[model samples]
Target: MQFRRTVIALLTLATFGTPATAEGEKAGAFDYYVLALSWSPNWCLREGDARGAPECAEGAARGWGLHGLWPQNERGWPSFCRTNARSPSRSDTAAETDIYGSSGLAWHQWKKHGTCSGLSSAAYYDLAREAYSAVTRPVVFRALDQDIRLPAGVVEEAFLKSNPDLDPDMITVTCKANQIQEVRICLTKDLIPRRCGTDVIRDCTADRALFTPLR
Candidate 1:
């Protein structure tokens, strides 16, 4: 009886190694990476009120905050790959919260995107922070002294100007209604800037998108 129970247990373990790990065997299997940066003011507006958001309140008008570093392929992307699902280690506390601008965002990103990177949680997040550091925020985002609206092309130009190596094809601008929502840039697996496939680009159709200044 004991032997039969043990055999059944072994079969179960073999059938389902681990929920997260089972999917992880293919982690880091991607063609490129997309680093998305959210425009803070617009994000706050979408969420409801800037008065309640930490990134927007108390004079904390951080122009751009990381959305995520997603691993992608030329055709489609993989998600929720495998992971231990453990929390970020002690050393990654700041990057997981402060650098990401929110602990919740950090957690979600790690589970959704970072897990697919095939990197340890700390390493994946550190890579994301590094990717964010590589991007030069466009001058327009530096300080919006007043509310302004500009063509999507103008915004793309700003990014190109700030990053000499970046071409229009490398940056994809997304907007929500009339507000600029996020800016996504393509990069190589090693985090070097690269030209992304046209299909992966999701540009906003708005003729002019509003750029809200820090509150």
Candidate 2:
């Protein structure tokens, strides 16, 4: 009877042990990583308006932040855009002038092709000296968080297959703490794009500028 009891106990343990070991192996099979990026509000100002102005003005003004995780890239830099301002002027005026003046500084940093001609001649040329002074100002980029695990042979095949626009090299993995919360992907750059020959960045849907890579 004692021998029979011992054999039964050993069998029960083996049945559970096999599955538990397999579960551990599955969990440990792949490495995981998280990446994070943040941008200041200065980075959100319209690039066209901020042109020729010192980069520091945007940093000094109301700042904004953007965060995300992406796969590692060997040669790509983080990108951001400036915010757009609106005016009711038919041609040009003071309100439009102010908007252009502020946005040009931002454009200079993010859009290599930005110009400040949309403002009236007086306003456009008046701020040139100030813009030139801030021209050499450095814009800051920071990686607030990172949790990269060493490479494993296995990858998250499903995730890679679903997101094609995202560069595989810049793929980011995110985990939520609460089951009810949803993950969010945010575009931190200004939603508006720069005009062809204007310093103003408009917020109207019909006039929105599409983001292009800075040259």
Candidate 3:
């Protein structure tokens, strides 16, 4: 009788508690959540003293390096960071570390925060610029023909119109003389725009094809 009681107790403990414990452990393994800033490295630096720092530093510091505005998860873990960094100058070009830090910080932030919400006006402006860039000069754009015909000034207008919440100065457009096919758009936190020759341009051939001339 004693042996049977002990056996039943052991079975109940394993059947009722082990799986829940395992799942809880698995869920708890992830540590933080991330909020991505979309402004270019140049604008990121101009925004503030802390904006250009790597995400790891922001996460560690528990805010955008400003006082008393730290982000916290339900479990109270700090979840966001300013992981972007400026490109190394010619004198110090050998740095091979990630522009941010390890994948661990990003992973942890994502796990904890899930997604960022209720961004400040500055953050929203930065995010809008990123979305505009994604729609216009996406990474996939490079795969298209370099010589593909693109509409003139349409890229600039479209980017600006798409992001109305930003200040006018935040959306600057410029084109390259050598690569007439290229266009670049820049947005800053203070809502200033600075055109750069090296920036990618949006192509509007697909839109032009959708409208046909009537006889």
Consecutive 10-residue window with the lowest summed lDDT within model 1: 16-25
Candidate 2 minimal-lDDT segment of 10 residues:
194-203
Better of 2 and 3 by lDDT: 3
TM-score of each: 0.81, 0.16, 0.23
Task: Identify the candidate with maximal TM-score.
Answer: 1
Cα error, candidate 2, residue 107 (Å): 4.4
Better of 2 and 3 by TM-score: 3
Off by over 4 Å in 1: 1-25, 48-51, 84-86, 89-94
Ranking by lDDT: 1, 3, 2
lDDT of 3: 0.31
Candidate 3 versus truth, CA RMSD in Å, comes to 21.1
Q: How does each model score on lDDT?
A: 0.78, 0.26, 0.31
- Model 3 clashing-pair count: 14
Give per-residue CA lDDT, model 3, range 39-125, as digits (tens): 222222333236444533322321111111112222323233222323223322112113223233333333332222234323432
> In candidate 1, what are the lDDT values of residues 167-209, reduced to their tens digit?
8888998888788988899999988888876555768878779
